[model samples]
Every structure is written in C-alpha cells, then in structure tokens.
Target: MSVTTTSRMRHLLTYAAFVAPAVLFFTMVILVPFMRAILFSFQDWNGISSDIRWAGWSNYTKMMSDTGFLKSFSFTIKYVLATTILLNVVGLLLALVLNLALKTRDFLRTAFFLPYVIGPVIIGFIWQFIITRLFSEVGKATGWVLFQKNWLSLPDYAFWSLIIVTIWHSAGYFMVIYLAALQGVPKDMLEAAEMDGAGRLKRFWHVVLPLIRPAMTINLFLAISSGFKGFDLNFALTKGGPFGTTESLAYHIYLDAFTKNLFTYASAKAVLFFLVLASITLVQVAVMKRREVEM
Candidate 1:
C-alpha cells in the first residue's frame, strides 16, 4: 500500500477503536432488547416456555378492555400532570428564593437538594415511615386531624401522597436547574426593567422568565418523563394500595409482567408507553424551543 492508503487505513482503525465499543454495547443492550420486545409483543409467551403462540394484535386489542390497565393509564396521566406542574412551580419558587443574597442560601440549597441525591427507593421508604408511624404519633399527641387520618389508606389522599413525595424528591433537582438559569440572566436587563419602573413581579415575568426558557424546557422535559416513569416511590410507599388508586403506568406494567405473568401483554403496553412518552416530550421540546429567547 502507498503512504496515503496506509494513513487512511490507520485513521479508520483509530476511529473504529473509539466507536466500536459504544456501537457494540448499544446493539447488545438497547437495540437487541428493543427488537426482542417488539417481537414479544406479538407473541403469547409468559417470559418462559418454548410454546410461544403468535398473538398478533390480540395483546394490543386487549388493552382497550382491560379496566385495570385503563385505570392505571388514567392514574398515570393525572400523576404526570400534577407532578409536572407542581414540581416546576415549587422548583422555580425555591430557585427564586435561594437566588437571593441570603447568608444561609448555600446551606439551604444543599439542604433542599440533599434529598434528590438519595435513591428514590430510600426516600420513599423514609417518607412511608413518616406518614405511617410518625404522623400517627404526632396526631395523637397534638390531636391534629390532618395527621390523624391515614393518608396512604385513602384513595384520594394516596394519589396526592404520591404527588407530594414525587415533588419533594424531585423539586430540588429542578430547582438547581432553575437556579443555574437564574444566575445566567443578565443583570443589566433586570436593572433596565427596574429603571423602567417595573415591579419585582413585572421584572421577573417580562425579563427573567423569557430568558430562562431553555431551562424551563429542560426541567419540563425531565419532570414529564420522570412523572410518567415513576415506579420506585409507588413500590416503596404505596404498592398501588388504597384500592389500587395510586398505581402508576410503570407499576401497573410491572404487575402485569411479574405478578400476572402477562409478558406479551406487558410488552405491548411498554411499547405504547415508549411511543406516548416520545411523542409528548418531542412536542414539548418543539413548542418550548420556539418560545426560547436567544441571548
């Protein structure tokens, strides 16, 4: 081979050396499993046994009539919406307050964000103990009706409990995103707004909000996806109790696959979930990106 040919071959080898591991892992871990899932969704297999029957569209069709799946779908939608709204709102509020020049702002930020660093399962179990045991004790001592009621035992309260815990667990992370965006806002713009006689709310609404739209986009995406995929908290805290009112889509899918041994049906549901999540997040990013201001 000539010198140019040898150099080109060497560069190709170098590039392959860098890229081959990622491609190989992707094929093995993600692509293979995804293809297998698609195949499984079309067959009647209980995750075992070689007697796989071709299910065709039956699993997909069964979802329409499966009331448990439908109820879980509804609950998941509500949970996503509630957590998305509240997490963003609470996170923004916390970011705003912590952005101030308070002496304890650093400590407060760390304190608030500390929970997010903990595993979701651990957080859920801790909160479960607080709600189940500590709350009862406090209620008995203080005679407070709020703590007296079993929050996890009531359907409505159980639903809100998931929301509350999700927000508590995740809001700090969102706050960090917002805080970073807040810090990146141009000081002169805020001063200009104030000089124009804009009040604090006006300055924030007109100036800061638009400038931080990118952060909003990211936070919204994370919140929506996290809320949709929520399972750890449901598992550790409620276990889809209170008449199964708190069952998230992920939890329901888990039960169908593991508990009921409906492997093919669960695969079908998982496929639908992936599509829905992809569509919603794409639309959200598209719309939010349009609103995002440059510079």
Candidate 2:
C-alpha cells in the first residue's frame, strides 16, 4: 500500500480504538436495558417467576383506569411546570448577578453550584429533617402558621416543599449554563445598546435574551426532563405520602413494581411514561428551536 493510504488507515484505526469503548459501554448499559424493559412491559411477570406470560396490550390499557397512576402523573405535571419555570428564572437571575464584575463572583458561583454536586437522595433526606424539625421549632417559637403545620403531612404544602428543595438543588446547574451563555453575549453590542439610551431592562430584553436563546433552550429541556423523571427526592422526602398526593410517576412505578408486586403493570406504565416523556421533549425542543431562531 502507498504511504498516504497506510497512514490514513492507522489514523482511522486509532480513532476507532478510542471511540469503540464508549459506543460499546452505551449499548450495554443504556440500549440493552431499554430494549429489555420494552419487552418486559408486555409480559406478565411477577419479577421472580420463571414463566413470563405475554399479556399483549393489557399493560398499556391499565393506565387509563389506574387512579394512583393518574394522580401521580398529574402531580408530576404540576411539579414539572413549577420546577421548569422556577429553575430557569432563578438560575438565569443568579447567572446574571454572578456575571457582574464583583470580587466575590467566583466564591458565589462555587457556593451556589455546591448543592447540585450532592446526591439528590441525600438532599431530600437533609431537607426533610430541616423542614420537619427545624421549621417546627422556629414555628413554635415565633408562632408562625407556615412552619407550625406538618409540611410533609399536608398535601398542599408537601408538593410545594418538594418544589422548593428541587429548585434549590438544581438551580445552580442551570445557572452555570446561563452564565456561560451570558458570558458569550457580545460586550460591544451591550455597550452600544446602552450608548443609544436603551435602559438596562430593555437592553437585556432586546439584546441579551436573543443571544442567549440557545442556552435557554438547553436549560428548559434539562429542567423539564429532570422534573418529569424525578424519583430520588420524591422517594426519600415524602415517600409519596400525605394521601399519595406527592407521588411522582417515577415513584409510583417503583411502588407498584417493588412494593405492590405489580411488576407487569408497572412495566406497562413505564413504557407509556417513556412515550409521553419522549414526545414532550421532542415537541418542546422543536418549538423552542424555532423560537430561538426567531428571537
């Protein structure tokens, strides 16, 4: 073979050697489990028996009449909406503040992002104690009704408390993304807008927002997906308690499969949940992409 051809072959082989492991790992870890789950969704298995009966579409149809499933899914929708908005708003606001030429910007950035580094289950347990114990003591001392009530025992306050913890846990992650996007906004454009007598808010609305649309797009997708698929916090914090009002779809799936021994039914619900999530994410990304280009 010619020297050029031989050199090209070695370079291709080198690249393949580096990429092959990641491709293999993903296929084994993610793709295999997903395919298996889809198959299991249609089978009547107690998750332990040797015989796995094919139940066809019964699993899918079960969701329509499952009150617990419906309730959990509904609550999840509310949670997703609350978190998506709060995380993006809070995250972007933090990013903007930290972006300012403050001497403590680095420390603030690290401090804000610190919570996200901890495992979410740990965060849930930690918050659970604070809300139940610390808040109760403070409430008794100050005679504040908000803290005195059983925050985790009441449906109205339980989900809100969950939202608070989720936003606090995840806002920093979104902030780092927004901060990167904000930093990429052209300094000259911002200065020129200011020179033209545009006020700060107008400058941000007109100039900064449009430039950071890409980041906003990504952040929205992250927040929505995370909120929808949230499990750890819900599992650890409330355990879907207070009349099952705070149970997320994910937690419901676990409860059905492991706790209730409804593995087959849970598998079906999992499949449907997968479809709904995939659809929402796809539609959202498409719409947001169009909006980003327009802005």
Task: Give the per-residue lDDT of model 1 (tens digit) for 1-295.
Answer: 9999999999999999999999999999999999898999999999877789999999999999999999999999999999999999999999999999999999999988999999999999999999999999999999999999999999998888888988889899999999999999999999998999999999998889998999999999999999899999999999999888989999999999999899999999999999999999999998888777343
* Per-residue lDDT of model 2, residues 184-248, tens digit only: 99999999999999999999999999999999999999998999899999988999989999999
How good is model 2 by TM-score? Answer: 0.96
Worst 10 residues of 1 by lDDT: 286-295
TM-score of each: 0.96, 0.96
Full-model lDDT for every candidate:
0.93, 0.94
Alpha carbon deviation, residue 264, candidate 1 (Å): 0.6
